[model samples]
Target: MNCTPIVRQHPDGQSINYYGVTLFDEQSSKSLKGIFTSWRNLFESAPNTFEITGNFVDWDNEQDGEYERININRDEVVNQLGKIISMSEHLAKGNCYLYHLGK
Candidate 1:
């Protein structure tokens, strides 16, 4: 499994910037889904600053993997609760941009 953290701007400037995770396999996708589900409440509490989306996308010419996008405000992440806070910290330590989180 591999996880890469990335930042993406909203097209047409319609929404806030997004933090994304590109997972290389089904196992990584499932694991991340569990973590995200466990923190769903924390995410829901801040609708504007936190959001999650998952989809399958081509990883290369012959493979596909899960792409998870989390819309976040860096400042607001510091105020979140529980494991969500820790996860945010981990991501931020990678500078909130393109960085590898797992392999």
Candidate 2:
């Protein structure tokens, strides 16, 4: 799986940069969703700055066998959250979709 940041401009004139995580299977998708939901408040806050402390799976790495997992430190989460919040501010008013590209 590969995690990439993508910036997209919509027809309506709104632009957003998505923190995309590619899932190879259903399990991975579910796991990712759970993580998002778990940190819903932090992501939704749109803080100019913030910090996170926990062990998170790093999607940038390759896994072995049936399951793959990489540990994401606190710094990485903070960085990713910052990007999401910043991009979200660019969204048109009343549009609540958190941009994410999955494949």
What's the count of clashing pairs in each model shown? 0, 1
Best by TM-score: 2
How far off is residue 85 in model 2, in Å? Answer: 1.3
* Candidate 2, 6-96: lDDT as tens digits: 2344332222223433212322333334444456555455455454454444565645223334444555566675554444443323234
Query: TM-score for model 1?
Result: 0.23
Model 1, span 8-88: residue lDDT tens = 332442222335323223223333434554566555565566556866565764355566786887345534544543554
lDDT of 1 at 89: 44
The global C-alpha lDDT for each of the candidates, from Candidate 1 onward, is: 0.43, 0.41
